[model samples]
Target chain A: EAGVTQFPSHSVIEKGQTVTLRCDPISGHDNLYWYRRVMGKEIKFLLHFVKESKQDESGMPNNRFLAERTGGTYSTLKVQPAELEDSGVYFCASSQAGVGNSPLHFGNGTRLTVT
Target chain B: AQSVTQLDSQVPVFEEAPVELRCNYSSSVSVYLFWYVQYPNQGLQLLLKYLSGSTLVESINGFEAEFNKSQTSFHLRKPSVHISDTAEYFCVLGADKLIFGTGTRLQVFP
Candidate 1:
């Protein structure tokens, strides 16, 4: 079975530019999550999506960041007016809902560099 | 608040040597612990997990972790690590939404 897939494995953008990272979850998985890891730091959770609706978004850093899951399939995270601090590896993960101990399947992640 | 902490930033060891990666988490009423490893250019994969019954859990790749509730720790250990074991290992908490620690990079040399 194919695992979670992320687009544009690497992305570089100017400080004020906007960037979007995409993630395609595993087939039939309803729980999609977004996490980011800054250099030398722990991976921090951003938000979680149960199908098309967002279940939690308390970890979002700011309002400039937006996340959307269309048709409950693929997810996209957008950062507008990207700041220098936004540079990091954005990882996307998916898991099946209702399973007690189901492990998450993650993507290779997209390394974003804001200059 | 929930959090995971991996004190060792990096550990260098020779092949066939025993290695331990320390991890500690904030004391909670109930917790699910996991160790996830990421090899070069690869995504993070579950190495092992400790849920309810057994405090000890083992992975197929000769790695094991014991959940110590009294100490609030879950340290990963490998009796004899292989060179291919070089990677970053993350200590994670939570069942659905995971809270990860600052991974420990284990570099196994020949």
Candidate 2:
């Protein structure tokens, strides 16, 4: 089985631009998660999705960030009017079960650079 | 709120030597502990996890971690490490969401 896959391994955008990151979870996996890691910082959770519905989104940084999982398959994270602070690696992960029960499979991550 | 701390930011050791990476967590509620490794240019992979049952957990790659509830620690150990063991290791605490440590970068020298 393939692990979680992220699109556009690296992205460079200007401040105030919009950027969307995509993630395709492993087959049959219903639990998807988004995390971000700024330079020299620990990875922080962004949100989670169970099928087409959001399980948790308390970690979202600001109103400019939005996430969607359509058809209960893939996920997309959109950052509107991206800021310089948004430059970091965005990781997408998926698990076979709910949180704390299954091990997560992560993608290579999308590195976003805002200038 | 839950938080994880990795005591060492980087550890340098010679090949075939034993190594230990320390991790401590703070949480008001019960949590699951995990260790994940990321090789160069690769994604994060699960090394081991401790949800319940045994306090000790071992991975297939000769890595082991013991969860000490009393101390609120989960330290990873490898008796003998290879050059390929060089990577960034993250200690995570899972409550409502996953809280991660800054990570410990292991560098193996021959």
Candidate 3:
């Protein structure tokens, strides 16, 4: 089966600029998750989408960061007025079954560098 | 609040030598432990996980992790590692939202 795929493996934007990262999860996968890792820090969860509905969004950092799964197929994360601290690798993952037995398959994250 | 900690920032070892990456978690109740590895220019991959029943879990790639409830720790270990094992390892807790450690970069010199 094809794994999760992300667009624009690397992105560079100046401070205050906006950037959008895209993720296409595995086919027929119901659970989609977003995660980010800043320099010298562990990967942090951003949000989770179960189909078109958001299962949980408790990890969202701020309002400037928005995520959308238009058709419950692909997801897009947009960062407006990006800050220097927003520079990191954004990863998207999907699982076929429940969180217990089904392990999450991750995509080659999109590395964003905000100058 | 749930949190995870990895004491070692980096570890270097010779091929065939044993290695261990320590991980600890703070949670009010029981939690699931997970170990993930990230290779250079690649995404994170599951190494192993301990949910219920067994306190220890093993990955197909020769990596193993034991979940310690009393100490609230899950450390990854390998008896003999190959050069391909060089990567960044992360320890995570739970499913809905995983609390990850700062990660330990392992460099296996051959």
Weakest ten-residue segment in model 3 chain A by summed lDDT: A95-104
**Per-model TM against the reference:** 0.97, 0.97, 0.96
Q: Rate residue B33 of model 3 by lDDT.
A: 85
Alpha-carbon runs more than 4 Å astray in model 2: none
lDDT of 2 by residue, A44-115 (tens): 999999999999998899999999999999999999999999999999999889768888899999999999
Residues B20-97 of candidate 3: C-alpha lDDT, one tens digit per residue: 999989999777789989999899998888889888789999999988888888999999999999999999998556
Which one wins by TM-score: 2 or 3? 2
Higher-DockQ candidate of 1 and 2: 2
Look at candidate 3 and give me any clashing residue pairs: none
Sorted into a CAPRI-style docking class, model 3 comes out as medium
Model 1, span B1-110: residue lDDT tens: 78888999999999999999999999455878899999999999989888889899999999999999889999999999999999999999984478999999999999
lDDT of 1 at A57: 97
Query: Candidate 2 or 3, higher lDDT?
Result: 2
**TM-score of model 1 (CA atoms):** 0.97
